[model samples]
Target: MDSPSRRPDRTISAMPQHTPPAPVVNDPATTPSALRRHLARWPTGVAVVTTVVDGRPVGKTINSFHSTSLQPPLVGWCVDHGSSQLDDWLAADGFVVHVLSADQIPLATHFANRSADRFAGIEWTAGLDGMPLLVADVPLRLECRVRHRLPVGDHTYLVGQVVDLTAGPAIPLVLQR
Candidate 1:
């Protein structure tokens, strides 16, 4: 019966140097970039919310997505008030949220760029209420109808009631910074 107290000390010469204490932000910075830097440490999954605007497919890459309810199956994400497709999303009949796979960084980057056409070379199909849905193989896809829209500060939080969804056994893309 060997006990921890009886165990031999295995310390070798100067292995694993002591790490410095993490930097602390005592007084929260006032700049927007400061807030971004503070929040960059928290990892989040990436999602592309798509809808039809002026008969064209519109989409945006966002990390602010979460499941608000299970029985009613409610999901929500936030969109910046300065987004060009704000009005389109607000008036959209429904939208689809695509959970990108771990290897889908290109797709996420394309959607994140506001200057690109977004869907010019992308493969997608029409979804519920004529909303645009990416055809790429992803981790999960949710078809949702607009449930609520609330303006908060510089962003608008959009809530959606998931009417249908599909999930797969795969890793999802996560954003850290």
Candidate 2:
């Protein structure tokens, strides 16, 4: 049975028919400008990447997660080079991805704030890999083990082996910036 607190479903049945078509602006010399144009057209969901780092909860807001391989059940995300949370996550062998519900805006905001100790006063449990499991009410969660790390440009690319997954039909939080 679904939890009583879960948000009522308000999903759209079909894609809006009033959307405009993409414009074609092909210019090899303007690739950099064109790339920025393309990036502005894509939308992505947001999530908080969390784990226990040296017995302390470490988390950061990210929108870079994506499935990499289904055969091996792999997922990946990129962490910026200058993030203080990056060092902590690099030390952790595993971590949890908390797919926050729309109602978790405050939780997301807390983690995004540079001055806030996001985990303080928040209830959580240790996962199988010693990663911190968020206590917030959400529809989906994933626990994954770090399988590989590749440095790309100014970020660290992490490939995680999905160890577990859970879903409960909850609405996901989205990021527009």
The C-alpha stretches of model 1 lying farther than 4 A from their native spots are 1-28
lDDT (C-alpha, whole model) for all candidates: 0.88, 0.80
Predicted structure with the largest lDDT when compared to the true one: 1
Report lDDT (Cα) of residue 30, candidate 2. 59
How big is the positional error of residue 45 in model 2, measured in Å on the Cα after superposition? 0.9
Candidate 1 residue 149 C-alpha distance from true site, Å? 0.2
| Clashing residue pairs, backbone N/CA/C < 3 A, model 2 | none
What's the TM-score of every candidate structure?
0.83, 0.76
lDDT of candidate 1 over 1-177, digit per residue (tens) = 789999988877876889897886775656778888989899999989999867878898989999989989999998888888888878887789999999999999999997748888899888887888798988999999889999988888889999989898879999997
Off-target runs (Cα >4 Å) in candidate 2 are 1-40
Supply candidate 2's per-residue lDDT for 28. 57
Q: How many residue pairs clash in all the candidates, one count each?
A: 0, 0
lDDT of 2: 0.80
